[model samples]
Target: MGRKKIELKKIECPKEKSSKYSKRKKGLLKKAEEMAVLCDSDIILLVFSPTSKPNLFYPHSRPLGRILERLSNMSEYEREERRSYTKKV
Candidate 1:
């Protein structure tokens, strides 16, 4: 059987929401791992629960610190590009 579409609104019942969250979170992490393995790509996933618990996923070859550092560097590069473009305009 196929899955049905789910609405984008918040689930009203806390118990139902929690159950859905747990199932979907596992599926999402599994998909991330599969993509990394099949595509030979680095994957890092960080999710916070409704109660603010952290769940982190790093593929076998990827390090969380390295991912954060690379993301920080990219943001800096993007900011510089934006500033230069603004100055030229």
Candidate 2:
């Protein structure tokens, strides 16, 4: 069976909101790891918690510093062009 669909609305209860966020964050991290592995693609995912703590994920085989350096060397236009190319593919 496919995954259940969650309603796209704010959870009104603070307890529920915190619980849901914890669950979803872990799920997202797992998916990011899988995508990096199965696709043999570079991925950099950075998420900030409600309290502003950062969580970073990238393939352990490739260093995050190298990816950041490569990304920094690209111009703004180049970044957008690459995004469009990937979207099309």
Best by TM-score: 2
lDDT of 2 by residue, 13-70 (tens): 8788778888989999999989989998889999987657898888899998999998
State which candidate has the highest lDDT: 2
- For each candidate, the alpha-carbon lDDT, in order, equals 0.86, 0.89
TM-score against native, each model: 0.69, 0.78
User: Distance (Å) between predicted and true CA of 63, model 2?
Assistant: 0.6
Q: What is the TM-score of candidate 1?
A: 0.69
How displaced is residue 7 in candidate 1, in Å?
2.1
Q: Write the per-residue lDDT of candidate 1 for residues 1-89, one digit (tens) a residue.
A: 99999779988888898898999999999999999989987778889987788998988687778877876777777979978999999
Global CA lDDT computed for model 1? 0.86
